[model samples]
Target: MQQRAAITLALASLLAIGLSGCGASEAVETSPTSTSGQGSTTYPLTIDNCGTQTVVTAPPQRVVSLDQDSTEILLSLGLADHLVGTASWTDPVLDSLAAANSGVPRLSDNAPSYEVVLGTDPDFVTASFGRHFAQGGVASRERFAETGIGSYLSPTDCDNGISINGGGTRTHALTIDALYEEITELGAIFDVPDRAATLIDGLKTRAAAATEGVDFAGATVAFWFADTKTPYMAGGLSAAGLLAKTVDLDNVFSSSPEDWPATTWEAVADRDPHVLVLGDLQRDRFPGDRLDDKISFLESDPLTQTIDAVRNKRYIVLHGAELNPSIRFVDGLEKIQSWLREHKDEL
Candidate 1:
């Protein structure tokens, strides 16, 4: 309780500082959700996305998404016809979206170069992480604008102050509302506001159904995203935290402010989480990216082997994208809810 109180206070202080600008109007209010309407978007739409004003002259007919999350969202909106190219994938495309996704071109299995993206003659671009617009990314928003192309960075990245250096940090806990806002804004940008509204409504319904009559209150849990030597555990202000909170599961590392903090196995073992939510990432970027590798390490490592979760083999595995702030987050939430219901007696 003391740790949670401190995190609350820290978030309050950050909010106060952000709103205490020279003038209230000058301050950018980072609401958890967007206020975009459900009406169709008019031509020459200007969206204030992540502190940058992106002006779309018309519905983008040739869009290039820099990440899998953004690409999936676009496909969900039935805009695959408009998506000319995509890159930076971590998992296979969602089965429901496979047919639509097949029609689009994969720019690269990873981050594509600026020239390569532009080669598709794209009029608009979208990314799920700030790193895509950073120094090593395809190009900055300013550079895209300079080339007469509009771009959007997911609000989750900028609104939460996620650093481009690593997994980044968050001052406040994130929720599904952020994903709703992204869908709404994207719908408007693509002149498909109704589609966005429908998507948000469906997600809300699914989330409600997932949590209905489910309560795992007081059951401490931990989310291990990747890495074995220095594991990136989920903190309070992330989608994993949201999943834990929704199911009333107490996140062991909720006190940390970083979205995915690199912590020692000793720290995780000390907390001794009752359940372990492992990310089954398909990416081969790191040593522990695979689910089998993660399980092998947990059962073999002396420090982790004795942990309550490892000893009991209480684990819930989710796809890589589900751990990140995106439409797939609901998938993670539902899976966790189901697991808790099935293992109620065991826990």
Candidate 2:
């Protein structure tokens, strides 16, 4: 989970607005309307994005991406021309994403201040996290609306109607369907319905190929994102969990309520996963979140070393970006299955 004051404020705002965090809207089953085969653009699009009503009167010409996942989406749809700025936070510069939008200016190394974002004169802003619109962050959704600037959040970050254990909303479970819905929705807003459809079809094919003939019935996996200080675990409702399901590996933390929850080392020890998937975060940007550090702890700690996975050194290093709710989710799934096939005996 993202431990930040901004998220706390966002949850409080949701409650203040009488949004009960218990359910989610149905997935978008149809592609947005388009002037197919004509090459002409369609517009005046209106979408209910993360419970916020967003209307784009025309294609957004100057877009600002506040997250890597959103940046990848814009580029994947051949909408790089519309992006005027992009930001980087947890993930490093992905070669494919960087090459797609070669000269697009980077507005910030991380989430930019509201002033810096406004300096770019963006007509639209897209983010993967809901806290991007917090009061002390980019202000609020209404504030952006007042300025005639449209904003969008990834549905996986939305909890408007989804309920959780402690009277708050857990991060919406990330899945392949959620990724497709986001791409399709963005396509409609940008007048590129056909492109979105084509992309989704390709992604679906990739996903299918990744899971074909894979049998992971007896294996159990744990996606460890952070350290023992307050070990951040990827719960069953997360993208990682969904990928585990696709590969047939049981997620050890599937019972946790939060998508990314602070877990106890003792609990992890008890579960004793068969494989440990390490999230290789950028240490410079995220100080202590190094993959090596986690490995060392698992191997050296007396208690942790006793676990079967630790003793066997069965670890899979995953780029943090691949694990996020993004287009690369399929790629992540493929990697996991391929690894399992190569090391089937480990199970």
Candidate 3:
């Protein structure tokens, strides 16, 4: 009787083990889930990606750019067709880009929240600024990875050091040349390399002509920006410096410790420049009011009246997209050179 009972118990144990194995096998057989957009073959949009290795096939159809520069970059690339949504940072310029894409719907009134991004059902997201990837912000690279969405960073401010956004910051030694090269690279990604090459070469030619100097090889210029409230001026290594180089003006701020450095009114008194490039005009003043008001301010301001630029009326006011880092920067250079030419007799 005992032997029979033991035999039945052994058989029961084996049966239980077999049933557990079947359950484990069923779990293993369940199909893995994936992000929605990859069902269709994701077409290759070859990306130069700033300095990153070329991406052969980047799946970025419904793109959401986080900042104004990123939005403008995308617009310039002629990839507006793939843009699903964008932010308010595009401001006054992209009204036309927006009108054309109005039917596509907005991702956010501001930099997008994660919820808004998810609801849009995006395949990929790209941004000019990295703030979107900060703690709790939408489209953080790590979080996007979880959902199998890709992200691309614009060369303007990679890895988020000291970023001068509206005001351009010079990163590489060959800042202007680098920008042109990157433009060509972008064209390749869009399958419009010829168009990109044409644009770059044309801009380079224009920039070269603008900088073809009468003289400034020995003279320094005060590349002033912003108001006296914050006292922001560009250094020799800043975007202002690059602009100065284009016009062949020596940068007075080369010794400045910071890119946008604050100096005492005394400092301006000390390193007074031959020309004053007032790149930052009064925000409320229209472009037309600039020359007159700047002339008046230079004459009236006790500190400015003694400066060579002020005495000679060599103050130049750069406006619109010219002041921004968009391709129009060369146009700003051309305008500055024109001002210098107009005042050549006095200098």
Q: All candidates' lDDT scores? A: 0.77, 0.69, 0.54
Maximum-TM-score candidate: 1
Model 1 residue 263 CA deviation in Å: 1.1
> For every candidate structure, what is the RMSD over all alpha carbons to the true structure, in angstroms?
10.5, 9.0, 18.0
Reference-based TM-score, model 3: 0.64
Task: Find the number of clashing residue pairs for candidate 1.
Answer: 0
Which portions of model 2 miss their true places by more than 4 Å?
1-41, 160-168, 171-173, 285-288
Ranking by lDDT: 1, 2, 3
Ranking by TM-score: 1, 2, 3
List pairs with backbone clashes in candidate 3. none
Model number with the top lDDT:
1
Give the better candidate number (2 or 3) by lDDT.
2
lDDT by residue for model 2 over 1-347, one digit each (tens)? 00111111121211122111110111123343333323334334456666576666667778899888888777777777778888865666556556656777888867788888889888888887766776456557677677777887777666663223213456545556667677767766677655666667667677777788888885888888876667888898877887777777788999875767888788889999999888888744532378878888888888889887898888877878777777777667777877877888877
**Model 3 lowest lDDT segment of ten:** 1-10
Better of 1 and 3 by TM-score: 1
| TM-scores of all candidate predictions against the true structure | 0.86, 0.83, 0.64
Candidate 1, residues 1-347: lDDT per residue as tens digits? 00000111111211121111111001112222222332345545666666676556567778899999999888887777788999988788888888879999999988999999999988888998888788877888778877777787887776534442224557667767677778778867766655666676667767777789888868999999999989999998777888888888899999987778899999999999999999998888888999999999999999999899999999999988998888887787788878877899888
Off by over 4 Å in 3: 1-59, 85-140, 143-149, 156-174, 188-191, 280-301, 320-324
